[model samples]
Structures are given as C-alpha cells and as structure tokens.
Target: MESNYHTLKRNYNQLIVITHLTQLLTYITGFGGLVVPLIIWATQKDRVEEMDAHGKSILNFQLSILIYSIISIPLILVFGLGIITLILIAILAFVMPIVNAIKASNGELPSYPLSLNFVS
Candidate 1:
C-alpha cells in the first residue's frame, strides 16, 4: 500500500504569517532573516498550504536585497548615490515583510516588488 503522506496538507495561516514576519529577524539579531524562514519553508512546505509560494517570495526578496546592497557599496564612491539606494533598500526590506505578513493572514500570496526570480 502506498502511503498518503505526500497528499496530506493543512491550513496553517498563522504559520505562514509567522514565516513572512520572520524576515524581520535581520533587523533584530542582524541575521537569520533568510535562514529562519528558509528552515520553516523547507520543513513545512509539504504540510502547509501556500508555504511554498510565500517561502519563495520571501527568499527572492531577501536575495534581491542582498544583491542590491552589494551593488550599492560600489556606488557609494560615485557621488554618494549608493547611500540613497541603500536607504531605499533598507526601507523596502523593513516594510514589505510586515505588509506581506498581513496579506498572508488574509490568505493572499505574497507579492514582493523588485524581487528577482531566484527560486523559481
């Protein structure tokens, strides 16, 4: 007999929302914004509804922020433009997770702007 484990799924909206909010860990402990959500997604995607989509969006957004920050470092020498870019990136990084967490709570998939498709 085949096991039904693969077909089992649960509606865990709170967990999904928590996954989105975990991205803010970077602001608090200076890291784990990516690692924490990644662990939750990896371990729960098969069991939780919408975990895959939310996880992918969060990872892509975080990766994009890292890339943007790296590129901005070079721009800092060019009339200090990188400073502005970094500030905008920081704001986006700080705000989007909270907004998406609310969306997740409402059963909506995350929509992270300017996020590159790194996972899909």
Candidate 2:
C-alpha cells in the first residue's frame, strides 16, 4: 500500500507564523532570515496549509530587500541618500515580518509591501 503522507494537508498556523517571524533572524544573527524561512517553506509547503503562499511572500520580500540594499550602497556616495534608504529598508524588514506573522495566526494570507515577485 502507498503511504498517504503526500496527500495530507495539515493546518499549521503556528508554523506559518514561525516562518514569518524567522525573517527577524537576520536582525538577530546577521543571517538566516531568508535561509530559515526558505528551508521551512521547502520542507513543509506541501504538508502545511498556506505554507507555499507564505513562503513565497517571505522569499520575495527578502530578495527585494537585498536588491534595495545593494542599490542603496551606491547612493551613499551621492549625498548620503543611501543611508536614509537603508534605514527605511531596515525598518520595513523588521516590521513586515511581525505584521505578517500576526496575519498568519489569524488564518489570513501574508502581504509584504514592496516585495517583488521572484518566486511566482
């Protein structure tokens, strides 16, 4: 008999919330904000309800932040505009995960503003 594991769809709001919050790991450990979530999403997307969507949003947001930060580096040489942009990006990166985590806990889809569609 074939195992039914792949056909199972579990409601794991807590895992989804955790996935969203993992974005903060970059702030704490200077890394893993993307890596952790990417791993979780990859491993659980098929098993956990809504994991794929949440994972995609998280990845896109992280990628966008990386791109924005890279562009801002050159702006730093142009009257310190990069500093301001970097600050805003930091704030957005820190805040959006918390907001999306709250939404995930409520069974709502996450919305990351300014994220590019890199995965989907």
Candidate 3:
C-alpha cells in the first residue's frame, strides 16, 4: 500500500504550527482543534513526500494527540465530573502538545501517552 506524504517545504513548518495550535485548540476552540487539523491533515496527507521526516514525525505526533483528545473528552464527560475533568484534560492537552512540538523541533520524536497512530 502507498503512504500519504506531505510535499511542501513550508508545509512542514505549517504542520508544526498547526499541530501545536490544534492541541491548544482543543481547549481554546473547544472542538475546532479536531476540525482544523483533520481537514489540513486530509488535504496534506497526499503530499507527505513534501514533508520532511521531522515534519512527518510532527504530523504523526499531532495526529495522535488529536485523536486522543477526540476520544478522551467525551469519555471524560461521560464521567460527569462537570468542567473540572475537562479542565484537567485541557491542561494536559495544552502542556503535552507543546512538549511534543519542542521535542520535534529539537529532532526528537516524542511518543504521546495513550495516543493512537493516526498518521502513517
């Protein structure tokens, strides 16, 4: 099977930014986080060749965070702890992604805890 690869040099930077923003968006935009990146990822998927290995790593890491948040928020709500649970998740969501981006920029691929591999 063929793999989808990003092919834009600037896009690698964009992916890094998008990844960071998407993670923050889970808390800031409340749902837009999932939407924007999913759309970008879908559009950018076919051009992975444009994306450098660093870019691919960032993309995969971001994808993992995004999918995890998508699944976790609803599950956290199912617990019904009222905003607090969400707030905590949001906090983690913010922190972890930032760390990932930093690590990515430093040429390290950080494995997100409980993240599913959405970018392959």
Clashes of 2: 0
lDDT of each: 0.90, 0.91, 0.57
TM-score of 3: 0.54
List, residue by residue over 6-64, the lDDT tens digit for candidate 1.
Answer: 33422488888899999999998877899999999999888787899999999999999
Best by TM-score: 2
Higher-TM-score candidate of 1 and 3: 1
| Model 1 misplacement above 4 A | 1-11
The TM-scores of all predictions, comma-separated, are: 0.89, 0.90, 0.54
User: Which residue pairs overlap in candidate 3's backbone?
Assistant: 5-47, 5-48, 5-49, 6-47, 6-48, 6-50, 6-51, 7-47, 7-50, 8-50
Residue-wise lDDT of candidate 2 within 5-111, one digit each (tens)?
Answer: 43342237788999999999999887799999999999998988789999999999999999999999999998799999999999999999999999998889999
> Per-residue lDDT of 1-120 in model 3, one digit per residue for the tens?
123333344456557555555656656666666666566656665664332443344456556655555666667568755356546656666777678667655545555565555556
* Sliding window of 10 residues with minimal summed lDDT for model 3: 1-10
Collision count of model 3:
10
Better-scoring candidate (TM-score), 2 or 3:
2
After the best TM-score superposition of candidate 3, give how far the Cα of residue 80 lies from its true spot, in angstroms: 8.0
